[model samples]
Target: MKYLVMVQGTQADYEAMRGKASPGSPAWSEQEVQAMYAYMSAINDDLSETGEMIDGQGLAEPAHTRTVTLGDDGKAVITDGPYSETKELMAGYWLLECESLERVTEIADRITRCPQPEGAPNYPVVIRPVMEGAGDI
Candidate 1:
C-alpha cells in the first residue's frame, strides 16, 4: 500500500519561530541552519534511494497564502488566507509504498526523531496515513 505522511505544525508555534527576529535576520544561525538542512537532506536522499519519496518540499511562509470560496451559483469569491488559522499547517510530506500500516508507523517513528538544529525550537511532525479506495492500485 501507498501512504502519505503529512507533516503538520501549529500556527502559534510556527509563528513563534517564524517571527523570531528582524526581517533580514536568519531564523536560525548559520551553523544551526546547516545542521537542519543536512539532517533533512539525508532523510530525503534515503527516501529517494529507497523509492519511497513521491514528492516533498518545505513551504514558504504562510504570509503568501490566498483563499477562495465558491457558492451554489458557481460564482467564485476570493479572500486572503490566514495560514495560521488552523491548529496545524502541513509543513512537508512524504509518500511511501510500504507493506503495512505497521511499517508506515515505523517510518513515522524514525521521522519523528528528526534532530532539531542546535538552539532551535523543538517542533512535532504530525503523521497521517492516506485514505485508500478500491480503485487504488
Candidate 2:
C-alpha cells in the first residue's frame, strides 16, 4: 500500500534554518543546514534504490501559500495563507509503497533522526495510508 510520510515545522523553524532566529527558534549555521540536506538526500536515495519511494518533495514556506475559499456570495475568494507564525505545517513528504504499517513507520523513524542543531526542536513525523481501492479507509 502507498503511504504519505510527512515532517512538520513552523515558519520559525524554516527561518531558523535560513540563518534567522526568532524568540523561540534556534538559528542554524550554513554548515548545519547543509548537513540536514545531506541527511535527507541520503534517505531519499536509499529509498529510491530500494524501490520504495514513489514521490518526495520539500514544500516552500507558508508565506508563499495562497488560499481559496468560498465567499459569502458563493464566489471563490482568494487570500494569503491562514497560517500563523507558529502554526505547524508540512515541511516535506515522501510517498512510499511499503508492505505494512511497520515498514512505513520504520522509514518515518529514520527521518526523525535526521541531523539538526543540538538544541533544535524535534518535530514528530506523520504517516497516513492512502485509500486507493474499495473499502480502504
Clashes found in each candidate (C-alpha, N, C closer than 3 A): 0, 0
lDDT of every model, 2 decimals: 0.64, 0.91
Name the runs in model 1 displaced over 4 angstroms.
Answer: 10-27, 71-74, 117-124, 135-137
Would you estimate the TM-scores of all the predictions? 0.70, 0.94
lDDT of 2 by residue, 46-74 (tens): 99999999999999987777879999999
State the displacement of the C-alpha of residue 74, model 2, in Å, after optimal TM-score superposition. Answer: 0.3
- Write candidate 1's Cα lDDT for 1-137 as tens digits: 77877666443434535435432232544565566568778888987898877777876445555668897889987776454345456667777777788877877777777755334444565555566876653
Judging by lDDT against the true structure, name the best candidate.
Answer: 2
The Cα error of candidate 1 at residue 42, in Å, is 1.0
Name the Cα RMSD for model 1.
4.4
Superposition TM-score, candidate 2 onto the true structure: 0.94
Name model 2 segments beyond 4 Å from true: none
